[model samples]
Target: MITIAKPGLLTSVQDLGRYGYQKFGVITSGVMDPVAHRVANLLVGNDEKEATLELTLLGPDMEFSEDTLISICGGNLSPTIDGKSVKLWRSVWVKAGSRLRFGGCKTGCRAYLAVAGGFEVPEVMNSKSTYIRAGIGGFNGKALQNEDELEIGTPSELSANISKILADQIEDKKFAEMQWTISSEFTVSSASKPDVRVMKGRQYDWFTTDSQMKLFTEPFEVTSQSDRMGYRLKGPELSLEEEQEMLSEAVSFGTIQVPSEGNPIVLLADRQTTGGYPKIGQIATVDLSIMAQLKPGDTVQFVEVSHKVAQQLYLDREKKIHQLKQGISLKIRK
Candidate 1:
C-alpha cells in the first residue's frame, strides 16, 4: 500500500481506457499519453494495459508501506526518493518507509508511475480508467485526494526477480535504479512550439481556401481552458465556405472540430462519442504523444501529411514498442 500525504494537482489511476461503450454515450477517459502508460507498465513487468498513476503537471508526495519495484516514465517531473533523484524510463527499487516527492516539472505535462504488479483498483466497464466528469472508474471514481491509501497488487515472477537484484544494492540507500534505460526514440517532445502532423478531415474541402491554407501555415496557442476532453486552440478563426446543417457523427481522439466559433478544438481522450462540428483534420496518431505533452500557452503548428505517411509512422512506433518489450524480457533474466 501507498499513502498520499499530499495529492498534487490531479493524480488518478488509469489503464488504457473504457472502450466499446462509446456508442452508448460513454467517453473514453484514459491516460493522455498512451505510450508513456505502456512503457511504465512494461518496466515493472506488468501487462501493457495495467493501471498506473497518471500524475499531472504537479505530482504527489507519497509514502510506501513496503519496499517495491517501480518505474517512472513519460514527463520529467523530477521524482525523488528521500531527496535523491530517480532516473526515468527504467526500473527502480524503493524501500519501505521511504518518502517520494516530485520537484518542479522540467519537461512534459504528465508522468506515469507504475509499481510492480500494478495499482490495485476495481475495474469499471472492463477498464480502470477514471472518467472524472462521470465519476465512473478509478479510485472511488475521482482523482486521488490527500490521505488516500492505495493497495498494491501482487507482482509477477519477473517483477520479483528484478526487485531482488535491486534489493541487494539498496542495503542502505532508500532506492536503487537499474543501469539501462529505454531509448528516447519514443519520448514525447516537450518543445514549446512543435510541428504536429495531421490528416485532412472528412470535410476539409468545405473550409474556405484561406482557412485551409492557414491550417497548415498558421500557429495556434493552446488555451488554459483545455482539459482531458479537448484542447481548444486560439489562432486564426476558421469558417466553412458556406454553412450547412449536418447530422451528428462519431468522433475519435484527435478529431479537430471547427464549431461556429471558428477556432479549432482537438478532441482528446475524454471527448464525447459524437459531434456536430465540422472536423478540420485528425491529428496523426504518431504525434499524439507530442500533443499530450503540450501544456497551456504552448503554440503548435500543424503539418499536413498524407494518410499513407501517417499509417507508416504509426507502424514504426509500434515496432519500436515491440522491440522494447523483447529487450526488457531478455535483460531481466540476466
Candidate 2:
C-alpha cells in the first residue's frame, strides 16, 4: 500500500491502454512511452500490461505503508527514497514507512513507476488507464492527489522470487543497497534533440514542393501549448495549392494535421479519434515514444521513411520485448 504525499503537476495510473473501441470514437489512453513503461514493469516482475503510476513533467511524493519493490524508468527525474537519492531505470526496495520523492525532470516529460504486483486500480472500458478528459478509469477517474491511498495487486510468483533474492543480495542498510540498475541497451538514442521518422500522408501532394522540402530540412520548435493530446509546431507556414474542407476520418496516433493556419499539430496518445484537417505526415510508432518526452521549446526534425520500414521497425521492437521477457523468466527459474 502507498499514500500520496504530494501529487505533482499531473500523475495518474495507466496500463497498456483501452483498445478495440476506436470505432466508438474512443481514443486509446496508455503510457506515452510504452518501451520505458514496459521496462519498469519488467524490472519489478510485473506483466507489461500491469497498471503503474505515470508521472508527468513533475512527479509525486509518496509514502509506503508496507515494504515494497518498485522500479522507475523514463525521464531523468531525480528520485529519492527515504531522503536518499536513487537511480532511474532501476529497481529499489523501500521499507515500510519510507517516503519516495521526485524532483522535476531534466530531459523528458513523463516517468513511470512500476511497483511489484503493479498498482491495483478499477478498470473502466476494460482498461486501468486514466482518461482525464473523458472522466473515466483509474482512481475514480482522476489524477492522484495528496493523501490518496493506492492498493497493489497480488504479486506473481516471479515477483515473489525476485524480491526474496534481492533482499538476500543487498547487505547494506543504506539506500544504495536496495538499488538495482536496468540495462541502458534498451534506451533509445536520437541523433539530435529528437529524431522522429515519418511517412508522407495522403495529402502530402497538396503542399507546394518548396513547403514539403522545408519541412524535412528545417527544425521545428514545440509550442508551450503541447500536451498528451497533440504537439503544436512552429516553423515555416505551409501553403496549400487548393484549400478545401476535409472530411472527418479515422486518424491514428502520430498523424500530423495541418490546419488552416498552416502550422502542424502532431496528434499523440490521447488524441481525438477523428480529425478533418489535412495530414502532412505520420510519425512512426517507435518514434512517437521519443516525441512524447519532448518539452516545450524543444527542437525536433522529421526524417522520411517508407511505411513498410516503419512496420518492420515496430515488429522488431515487439520481438525484442518478447525476448527480454523470456530471458527474465529463464533467470527466475534458475
TM-score leader: 1
* Local accuracy of candidate 2 as per-residue lDDT tens digits, 135-217: 88888889998899999888888888777776776565433233435456566443356778999987888998987987788
Q: In candidate 1, how many Å is residue 119 off?
A: 1.2
Per-model TM against the reference: 0.98, 0.95
Evaluate all candidate structures by whole-model CA lDDT and list the values in order. Answer: 0.91, 0.83
Q: Please, what are the lDDT tens digits per residue for candidate 1 over residues 32-133? A: 999999999999999899999999889999999999889999999999998889899999999899999998888888899999989888999999999998
Query: How many clashing residue pairs, candidate 2?
Result: 0
- Give the distance in Å from residue 60's predicted Cα in candidate 2 to where it truly belongs: 0.6
lDDT winner: 1
Q: Which residue pairs collide, candidate 2?
A: none
Go through the candidates in order and give the C-alpha RMSD of each one to the true structure.
1.0, 1.8
Worst 10 residues of 2 by lDDT: 173-182
